[model samples]
Target: MSDATRPDPDPSIAELEAQEQRLTLTRFTHDDAWTLGSLLVELARQRQAPVAIDIRRGGQQLFHAALPGSTPDNDAWIDRKRRVVERYGNSSYLVGARYRAKDTTFEASSRLDLDRYAAHGGSFPITVEGAGVIGTVTVSGLPQLEDHMMVVEALERFRDS
Candidate 1:
């Protein structure tokens, strides 16, 4: 079939809704945020690291904590995490995947913008499998690798519990 004669691929309504659902990070509750924050603080202590952490539900702040000596610069990670996840509908890992796929512009620029992406930090989508995004956990105050690791650890703990 000629390219022009082929029908364009389009999703059914249910498929479209499912896709939208997966991408939607719904607002979290104050309680949920606080819980996640406490988990992060505890995780940081276990790692023996002084880090600043922020947890958000949708666009709202649910929890925030700065370890001793954490600076203002550390606090911005959460915002960056939110911005990246909000735009990409995926976690930092997914963003990294996109980078690997040669779609590096958004990921690269997002990492550079402190207001929306931490160079080494990660954004974890607080979502259930097939449910879409519900919130995010963003942690900073260490190398980007460490920051991402910490967030991953915290999410595992939260998810398992």
Candidate 2:
């Protein structure tokens, strides 16, 4: 694709931070988790995207699903990505982008066990108006960006609804 036809670059770290600020929820209940999780599942099915979706509040898992063609490996990825969100209180994609923006990798700089914590995309912090980051919503089985976008899109729709 020509430069003009090329997709825009991923948002900058500042832009991603702004997105986190903007996406905060007024409230998040168990029912909201169910609505959001079901929305994600519906969207993925519409796209025929094989993926695993997970929603958690602190140590409590609120919702989870493994779509057609998804595998146990996607569950592993969900855990790793969710760990990143829990640790940083930021979206996993934003954390990874921050490292990349500094011309480094999370694995190289974090000194954390790669098997336990993945700073890859797909996991987003679920921040409430005043509760801070109460949980995480994550997806796996797609490319990092696509996985992240899927969660983002689902959240936006949920928020609007």
Candidate 3:
């Protein structure tokens, strides 16, 4: 079937929520952040994706990288997307999807300053066992969906390894 005829590849809210639940880490430390961040950098390098990645915990940025083609704007996007994850304690993609499913955009429904917050994809909460969301992993410089998927892929790899 043509791509247009295929079902949307994006996961449903339940699926994304399950991801958040299932991907919980036993513990996350500075070293863990380094590993995850390095993994993301490697993935992006392999893909030749021009993206900016950021990982933060306890309100402190642990790692950040801007790939060759990425621009400063990507940093802004990272911050905005991270804010969504921070405020909602869910992946930014999930938050945006929930709003879209409700027949409204997050920009219209959230009533928050658009400059500081974005409901677009690319940020995932770093949830640990026995702790809620400890931080966020975010990417920018790709389409929102791609950005979100990249983070999810890295998180899965990090968890599995």
Candidate 4:
């Protein structure tokens, strides 16, 4: 039988194609970084939560800040954020995917405690045209959704810049 006449085993073939096509990250510039950091602080203040923000480039710290009374958990958040940023080059999306994957690493109900190292906030991979993942910016200390929102907004702002 022709391939068209054969029944497809994979139900999500169409969806998978769409996802792969959409998994793109755009480049940003140096001025974009300043705007991102500024918006991050603004969003945290608007939410009435203390925040810890870290920006890294070339595997080195570019900028770091902590609002008053930021919790100790920020340390772990930073590490996990860095990992996700490195893994997917987009912190919020990859972290969400990790949570949803069937054989997922972030499964908490299972014997393995992926929750310990699991992160659910916002981190983003900073990239350039000819280079990739030159840096990352991670933020924590608000509600998970808000944290992701903050990063998305910053990236959007950077996108326009």
Of 2 and 4, which scores higher on lDDT? 2
After the best TM-score superposition of candidate 1, give how far the Cα of residue 20 lies from its true spot, in angstroms: 16
- List, residue by residue over 1-161, the lDDT tens digit for candidate 1: 99999854432335433433443333346776787689889878877777888777666777888888688877766576566766666565445544545745454554455555632345666764545676777777776656766766665555556
Report the poorest 10 consecutive residues by lDDT, candidate 2. Answer: 7-16
Best by TM-score: 2
Write model 2 residue lDDT over 75-125, tens digit each, in one string.
Answer: 999999999999999999999999998999999999889999999899999
Candidate 4, residues 1-161: lDDT per residue as tens digits? 99989965332424432332332346544565666787777777777668888777766676777887687788578767677667655554455555556455454533434544444656766666567667887888776656655666766655555
* Displacement of the residue 7 alpha carbon in candidate 3, Å: 5.3
Q: Which should have the higher lDDT, number 1 or number 2? A: 2
- After TM-score superposition, the amount by which residue 57's alpha carbon in candidate 4 deviates from its true location, in angstroms, is 1.0
Ranking by lDDT: 2, 3, 1, 4
- Judge candidate 3 at residue 58 and give its lDDT: 74
Ranking of predictions according to TM-score: 2, 3, 1, 4
| Model 4 pairs whose backbones collide | none
The positional error of residue 136 in candidate 3, measured at the CA in angstroms, is: 0.6
lDDT of each: 0.63, 0.94, 0.93, 0.62
**Candidate 3, lDDT over the whole model:** 0.93
Write the residue-wise lDDT of candidate 3 on 1-161 in tens digits. 99989978888999889989988899999999999999999999999999999999978999999999999999999999999999999999999999999999999999999999998989999999888899999999999989988988999999999
**Which 10-residue window in model 4 sums to the lowest lDDT?**
15-24
Clashing residue pairs found in predicted model 3: none
lDDT of 2 at 141: 91
Q: What is the C-alpha RMSD of each candidate to the true structure, in Å?
A: 10.7, 1.3, 1.5, 9.1
Cα-based TM-score, every candidate = 0.68, 0.96, 0.95, 0.67
